[model samples]
Target: MTTEPCVAAPVRRGVAWHTPLSVAVLCAAVWLAHSHWPLLRGGAGRLAAADQGWLLLGATATLATWASAALAQQGAVPRRLPGARLVAAQFAASAANHVLPAGVGASAVNLRFLMRCGLPAARSASALAVKAAAAALVRVALIAVLAPACPGVVRLPGVSPTGAAVVAATAAGLVLLLCGPLRPRCRRALAAVGGDLRAVHARPGRAAALWGGSLAFAALHALVLVAVARSVELPLPPARVALLYVAASTAAALLPTPGGLGSLDAALVLALAAAGAPGATAASTVLGYRLLTVWLPLVPGLLVLGVLVRRRAL
Candidate 1:
């Protein structure tokens, strides 16, 4: 009888916190949209003057990205997931992704969905790690293939001795920090991920789906940027734009910003400018890209998230 109150107390506390967290997430979304309204408004005006056909192409590519993501996610685990729900979860996860740094929100949403699908927690986490590793590998591969086609599009910045030392010191510090308290846990997690990775690769169909979906997701994103550039009539070649998009996105991953917001925007603008686009055109291309990828789908994505939660799908 005494344990009942103790258990009920935690449940009540969880309910209390969950309500506020939901409210906070909604409020943050509104605030973010409100803050970016001016930029979106101005970008809309610019897009209004641009080529609608290219913009439509960009939007279509944007829609295709979510499907690619769902495919990659399914390939991460061996279990069969409901196709429609998986796609819906990915769509909702994209919206949630913008609310937190370094893909936390999206990861959380997917993690929950995976758990609800009946996978053990450890396996589910390993699946996520596998998916991320596949995505990273695919991004690097794309960059390597595309970079050669667009000579001089990406130039290596020379790091001074002091800057190199600082970077090395920062990396060493992070390594030591992580190694201290989390070493054992990290080791166990890595082992689990390695096991899952091997199990996944043992099946040729799963391996193909994982790599193919990852490649498609990255390619589609690059295509969206290329289409946006075309819409704005940016002078850069399509190949060059695609190369710059992949390279810039890879570099921006180092920044822990929510959905690569500021980091990606800045990297892309600079990349386009370096590739010979006029400053105004470069900015316009980024704005249009963001409009299709982030802002336009945000509200609807959130609505889907709410429905998923209500239906207990996530």
Candidate 2:
């Protein structure tokens, strides 16, 4: 009797030099665009230098957002990554995300790190799914809550016809995809992509907690955006500041810019102006915010990348 030869299991892919290099080029392009955004908008010259309170508050809030996001990541996956370890992973992920193409390299870093932490590939994929869902839920809840509080948010030009429609459609589509026949198809698609998902459906309480955490995290980040605005002497309200921050941040994150680099700067300037802030102040505020959030992270990310590469951990 002739026996069929055993099939080979799929091997994990190696990191390629070209991949990182292309991502780096994208990052550089985005960073350059961000650096020049204020100048392009003719607002660079009018910016008031960031004051101490603004810087301090903004920095603190940004840290809080980062920490909370790290915790959310842990909660979603529960690969038993220690807080410190997870924090380091987050930093590495953020660094890679900023320096990678499509911002997807961060997911690779995360997958590798979790695997090293002893999670099965399937479980890790599930964790990523949960984290993504939780983040989306939180963002949606924010828009629902804030849209009412900030009346002008619903009134922006093209808000109702286009933005709102797209938002509603996207949210509905996600809901549909997560239910019934659509869900089965979605799961199959994910499975095709090497996602051996052991389904861990989100419980209501857990979902609430996750969304709550994300909301608080986003709010803190919004406060930082406000601080940056104030630092540039923008005459904008805190509510408007928060609303626009959420909207623009959502847009930038969805965009394919490296870590939303250039898009983020432009988004802030536009959102601030739409929310009634002066153009010059909005432009400068965006520049200052990018400096703290994006530019400040680059050096550490590079350091982490070097270390990770040397250790063969990436």
Candidate 3:
């Protein structure tokens, strides 16, 4: 029933701070959308004539992605969330994810939900962190497993200096997390996360749900991409297409774009091209993938988000 004190502080600010930040994020999303509009148009034109059955299948898989996310989120915590409401929260979380950078919006929503479900703020955050870490690990593992199966699917593109610098900075940050001087609360958070990890794994069902749901989430997303490619008559095999999705999505994660908008599109297009699809097919594939995954469901997702908020479920 109570919101986090930190969360309440910002809410009390009455959009004074939120307005500018929201506008900035919205502007960035718009710029990226505008730049990528041509591909969407081209993809739409092709999809207009695409196979409806496969497109429908892609849509089904996209829906499955939300379910998988819900399962994974539930697995992260010990307490049970009402199944129907939990899934709806995840649906709303997906919409929130598109509005904010990285996943701040989604995390805020889920954190509030977990707290309302009777967890303390620290445990709710730790649960979220554990779910995120498990999902990320599963994704990388899938990429490694699939990359070898499809020999040429991933390539060592020449790394630019900027990319190298980014990698170095990331490595430095990781090292700092391990050895840096920390405040008492920071140290406690690390302890809590570690404890949460062990606690989740100690329960067989939780462990299975955590890992299994994470795997399913990644697989469902890749399946959606594969089905979209098929709908547009792209010639790649499903396995190869799935490989490309995992790799592209993993790479896109580094960019921190909302819902992986621009970065994901670009990486996916490049990945498909590397997989030997024709230019139009590759473009159409990316376009169709985004359409099913992002555009088509955006409005409904937002509406669901609003309903959840009105109900105080998020």
Predicted model with the maximum TM-score? 1
lDDT of 3 at 91: 83
TM-scores of all predicted structures: 0.90, 0.71, 0.83
lDDT of 2 by residue, 174-206 (tens): 897788668876776567333322322234433
Q: Rank candidates by TM-score, best first.
A: 1, 3, 2
Q: Which digits, one per residue and each the tens of the lDDT, describe model 3 over residues 5-117?
A: 22221233343443454455455455656776776676677788999999999999999999999999877876667788889878878877876778887898799877767
Top-down lDDT ranking:
1, 3, 2
Can you give the lDDT of residue 43 in candidate 2? 38
- Which residue pairs does candidate 2 place in steric collision? none
Q: How much lDDT does candidate 2 score?
A: 0.66
Global Cα RMSD, each model: 5.7, 8.0, 5.2
Q: What is the per-residue lDDT of model 1 for residues 181-221, given as tens digits with 9 covering 90 to 100?
A: 88899999999999878887888777887898899999999
TM for candidate 3 is 0.83
Clash pairs, candidate 3, are none
**TM-score pick, better of 1 and 3:** 1
lDDT of 3 at 54: 93
